[model samples]
Target: MRVVVGTCGFQRGRRIHYRLLDAVEVQQTFYDPPPKSQLESWRREAPENFEFTVKAWMLVTHGYNLRLWRRLKREVVGDRSAYGGFKLTRENLWAWSVTLESASALKARIIVVQTPATFRASEDNSERVVEFFNNVERGGFTIAWEPRGTWWNNRDLLEETARKAGLIIAGDVLRERLPPRGQEIVYARLHGLGGAEVNYRYKYTDSDLEMLASIICGGGWREAYVMFNNIHSFDDALRFKQRLGGWCGS
Candidate 1:
């Protein structure tokens, strides 16, 4: 198995990034998709071996009313709650459409959909997820979901939904979880964790990297992407590659 590792965002210059990382989970997509010209510019600067994955816009996941329009940089004046969410609504599709444009510009392969902590695991939400995934025009793109909150407690629902939709259930490995179901690829995010949840200030230890390395090695997965999502992400990603005895590289 091959492990493609990198930080959540570019912590260094494109030239330096080309030397240290093989992939990046672009965080800007969640807030606003960069202009196509900018995406193309980054793509041009990156090496052919480098890969990018993007976080989908919050409009498709979070239910924050007008806050959604601000994040998407659009003018949609209405009852904020009526705009977007996990629902298979017109607004959600529009948001995804915008996100896809950026992904195409950057030649990104994976697009992550991360719901906020308030998104519960009710049957209605599960059904909404299925409807959205089934109807969306994916254009050969892979959608990985990192649903926070109560989802962490319901493996059965997540596995079933992901399998049926051909979606991958992304895991935050620092929370001691792996992809709910094995697919051709595995995607993991490591946000420095405290005993309970993400501790953005935390740094990884050598032993922690070893534990993650074991998971990335293989378990019916052909490829694994391990991305760091914390203050020390760049250094943590580098040390993880080192711990793997140089098995990882750009």
Candidate 2:
């Protein structure tokens, strides 16, 4: 298996990150997408084989009430009432268009659509999840769904929907397991296990890294993406690559 390890964002500066790791999951896109020119410049500056993965904008997954909006720039103006919920509304469509454009600029291989804990497992929500993916123009990029809360309870529904829409189920490998279906590509995020939901400050132990490595390499997937989201993400990811005997790459 081709297991590539990297941080969720540029924990180090871009130049250092690009030189040390072969992959990165751009985090700013989740809050505020950078200009297309900037993303294109990043693509130009990185190594030819460097791989980029983009986090889908919150406008497509989060509700307006969520505190995540506080990080959004004041200059970003729009009637956000119709945003999020994965609905087939014009606002959500526009949000997706921006995300697609950003990914296209970076030549990213994956776009991670992360939903909040409130986005629970229900018939209506499930239907919308499938419909949104089916309707969106993915721009030839793979879509990874990182769902939170009770969505894990109904694996059958999750598996069926993913198969129908061609999605990769993303999860914190330490907290949850990736669905066995769609093993062609596995996306694993390592958010520290310190708290109930997610604790970015917690550091991973050596044993945790070993288990994580086991899970990624044990799978039948042809490729695996391990993105660390903890405080020591960069150091941990570098250690993870070393543990894998340096075979992991973009």
Candidate 3:
């Protein structure tokens, strides 16, 4: 099994982290898709064995949250309010296209589509989910879905959707203990503990790291990715690597 342990985003500089970590789930692409040259430059700079997973832009999932729309004003390529939830709107389709191009440039093996807690598992949303995945050309990469909110409460729907679409049900392993929905790829994000669905400020304990390592190593996945999204991601990721008998970077 090939196991990759890293952070949601580099805690230190990319140059430093690139040497110390072999994987990273790019977060910036979700807010704005960077230029192809920049993405390819990143992929080129990294070691050949490195794993780069990109997150789908918010325009693919979240609705018209004016707050973020205003925040991403300069970054917004076009109308920011055009996509959200499970609506396969024109804007959302454009966002997916751009996201795929970025992933191709980065030579990413996985792409994450994370939905906010507000995105419930209603019939409309579920059907939209089916349409979106069925229609989108995922290309050579694996599509991982991190559905937040009540979707977590409905494992059957999540599993059915993933099985049908060939998606991995990526989730916070700390909160919900779910086996890899797909044998192809196992993906997990550590978003800290004890604060809503995500506690970004929390640091993991040694015991927590031990338990995490055990779960990840025990999971029968062909490939596994563990990413730390908490503030203590740097330290925790390093420690987890050590526990997993993993080395730093290539």
Candidate 4:
């Protein structure tokens, strides 16, 4: 398994803790805006064998101009007042691509677009999802789609489309929304084994780690990127990495 660890922020500098990781997930600017220089410096300090995966900006998932209350209204009451002024089109995707490409010099492995839970799966929504992937494909980057809903109800169709387009399925142990197995390349964001989840931390048991390790070992993904969202400090992630390394005999 080719594991990638995630960090809340990478702006401080890469020399901080990236040496302990095979890849680092940049999550700080996913909501606010892009900071090219900070990301670039991370790439410079990262090990030669290291890879980086960045979370797509929130504008891509949450609608750039739509306000929080407006989005809630739309989801709860199906209101269009919030969307009336915003131009949600393919063009905006290019802006995200540009931001992603800013770190191209670092040879990023995958650009993760984690759709909010509000975006449900339906025939119409799936078409829009396909269109989004098509637009992003135009730019030279590999995309990993992580939809929160049970979007893979049509796994055959969704997986076929994803395979044809060369997009990777972002798998998660906690969600199980997507197929549990099978994909050319797999990208997973492991939040934890699941239990009493706090705001940012999760307590993963030994059995949970073993189970995930089994799936990873069984699938034989060309490369697997695992980002630990349970990070309160680096200790948990470091311990998990060590545990996973032992499992893999790395």
lDDT of each: 0.79, 0.85, 0.80, 0.58
Instruction: Per model, state how many residue pairs clash.
Output: 1, 0, 0, 0
Q: Which run of 10 residues does model 3 get worst, by summed lDDT? A: 241-250
Q: Candidate 1, residue 177: CA error in Å?
A: 1.6
TM-scores of the models, in the given order? 0.91, 0.93, 0.92, 0.76
lDDT of 2 at 10: 93
- What is candidate 1's CA lDDT for residue 47? 90
Residues 1-250, model 1: lDDT tens digits? 7788898888887677678888888888777777889888988988998999988877778766555556665444344564445677777777788789988988999998887777788778888888888999897899998888888788888788788777998878657677854477888988787855577788998878877776677456888888898888888998887668543222
Per-residue C-alpha lDDT of model 3 across residues 1-250, encoded as one tens digit per residue: 7778889987888876677777999988887677889999999988888889999988888867767666463244556566776566777777788889999999998999998878887667777788888888787788889998888777777777777777778888888646444466678899998979899999999878777767676777777788999988988887887667642222
Worst 10 residues of 2 by lDDT: 241-250
TM-score (C-alpha) between model 2 and the true structure: 0.93
Which residue runs does candidate 1 get wrong by more than 4 Å?
65-79, 246-250
Model 2, CA-based lDDT? 0.85
- lDDT of model number 4: 0.58
Q: What stretches of model 3 exceed 4 Å from their correct place?
A: 73-81, 180-182, 246-250
- Using lDDT, give the best candidate's number: 2
TM-score for model 3?
A: 0.92
Q: Give one digit per residue, the lDDT tens place, for model 4 in 130-212.
A: 66555553346677877665565667666765665566777575455434355656676765544532235665666666667
